[model samples]
Target: MLTEAEKAATLWIQTGFTDRTVIQAAVAEPLLAGQSVVGVAPTGSGKTLAYGIPALSRLVPGAGLQLVIIVPAQELAIQIRDVLTPLAKTLGLGFQGLIGSANRERQVKKLREKPEAVVATLGRFVDLLEERKVVLEEVKTLIVDEFDSFEPDALRDILSFRRGGLPKQANLGLFSATDNPTIVSEFQAAWPDLQVINETSTDNSRGVVHHLLLDRQQAGKIQVLENLAREKHQRVFVFFNHKHVLQKVASELRFKHVPASMLVTDGRQVQRAEALQDFRSGRVPLLLTTDVAARGLDVADVTAVVNFELPDTLTTYIHRTGRTGRQGANGTVYNLGDDHDLRDLRKLVGDRVALETEPGEKKAYRKSAAHSAGADETRGVERQTGAGHRPGKRLTSAEEEAASAKKRKKKKQRWRNKKNVGKHW
Candidate 1:
């Protein structure tokens, strides 16, 4: 049932991926048939190729702008352009990237040439559209990658063109790793016949990933990172929750002569590009970044991902860890935090990924009654801390309680003595 174009496109990409991912299988035929689809697949499940192949199949060389792929970040725009450029070339189609922090004059010059496809950041694309440098009337397919991450106003402005909207026949494709009901509903209302596919439930593309917990205080974070950098064959992505913290960590790592690069979403485009390039080429083993900057990155063979700080939400954790273990490759996720941070992380991820102790770690996270039943089934040994406990000794619940009571009594007595000495009994 494949169209001639679709058949040719599929054959061309087969050499890259051994098997079709769930998202690819579910979306290829429908998209090629010009059906609007909203695909929700796990991160690293090959969403780019799933959408790219079909989009290319429908392109006509020298046919003006027929496809517009909108992404959240500038880096992501460039990444997608790099990914699909060769495929587009094989089909005699022209593809170019339009992003912020790059040369607009150059992009406009390329636009003048009538490229068939464009991967663009929303803001930059809108600027061009407003300036009348690009037109959407001929655009047959519009793909919004990481749809949930886009701001509604910017997206609405682009979709509801000032001159007019996209051609009525233009089909849409929205893709993301996580789902936002509000965004989905808004999009669904715009296209009543939108085929919503939830492949996360059935998508099993993840590889053997080990989620490790490294217990370290805030002060020891730099030392831990320095040690991780020396590990052989480790292409690590160090994630941070805040910009200030990421900056501080990056400064410290650089001072320590650790060959780690930092990537910030708001930084200079050339610097960000260079950092990613160095990391990808293995000239550097560590790349420090925030979730926003690294969202939807498709870097290969990321041996490990270290959380210098705990992620803010479960979705963030999933995206961060999903960077590794891509395409059935073995990877590790190291979480560097204190006991309190570890507890918060355990609660955030819940029973989704088991948090195991680092090898040779004598003390590991102890499961409390508040943890889910599945979380208690950890392979690591339980950790205990209280007064009168030996370095490597285990204590029963009752014994631990007794020790706590004794410590509280001693502390109360000391406080009373200090108050009496001050004549405040």
Candidate 2:
């Protein structure tokens, strides 16, 4: 008999996932045997198909909520739903996305319809559990995408698990582009039989060129960006560490008449969804977003990733760059740096990132930038190349604790005042 991955890939026929990667193949072995799995793989290496195909092959027809997929963000939930829904249809399965920003009454109506699979943000899923609109006892498998960022304590509110009625031997699939030791250790301690898989790659950054531009107090960052956008005329994802900065950069891009928008994680689901749609459809070619877009965002044909400011963590740096050069496509990554960023840059990307005075044109120094006379309007001057090595050490102590604590507090607050959490009616 053909294995589950083989069977599904064969049926996929260049539809969902034509070929499986190393981690995808490795993850299949255990899922075929109905075992729990946790994995770490490079971003954009087909991580979705790595888990989706196996989970789909195991979908239970007419089984209420047989599969529960928990994601870290509403955008990711919708994106995954979009990717898996078509594949599910190819196999005659039904799935629903239950996110925070959508109508609950409609979702309750869909609940009446009993979708075999559900993609949900952890908070919204807990909300449904509290309202008794869904039963987790029917869930045979729980897949946590972006598990690294998913709060481990969110599992404490799961109706079935909390009530000691969790579906018998329920399987788990925890996956992410980066690994969180705290999250993984907790999961392993809870499920001693779980299988673990991690892939560390230096070449995943291959086919990508890295460039560094020095900004003295970010004086010329926006102008440098505008020049690139006008010359390249392609989609670019610019990352800012702060929400306010993201808004400011996005506004500057728009004022400069660059087709641009911003992505805010905590923003309303409807609004954020629309912005992403506009960017994806090429209605806008530039998106200014925070680190939330650093991982699990699968925007197609991004020509470059601009780090308006580099993130503090190396794993985040890797994921930010991972946004481009995806699936073997060539891309350029622009990193803005300064005197303070030099030591950190050397530690993260090392010699692979080439330093430059600026890209395209070097004009007479001015308070406001203007294209140099005799400069190529194409602005295709210097092209330098570089590659990255490995993930940085564990994040700062405060950051680690804060992320976990915030997740727990959010989960707790969502359920504390809600009645019927322990009732079925």
For each candidate in the order shown, give its overall lDDT on alpha carbons: 0.76, 0.67
Which pairs of residues have clashing backbones in candidate 1?
none
> Global lDDT for candidate 2?
0.67
**RMSD (CA, Å), each prediction:** 9.9, 14.9
- What's the true lDDT of residue 94 in model 1? 94
Clash count, one per candidate:
0, 1
**TM-scores for all predictions:** 0.82, 0.78
What's the CA RMSD of model 1 in angstroms? Answer: 9.9
Candidate 1: tens digits of C-alpha lDDT, residues 331-367: 7777887667877888888998877754333444544
For candidate 1, what is the total of clashing residue pairs? 0
Candidate 1 TM-score, true structure as reference: 0.82
lDDT of 1 at 259: 89
Kindly list the per-residue Cα lDDT of model 2 for residues 321-342, writing each as its tens digit: 7777766767777776554564
Model 2 pairs whose backbones collide: 352-386
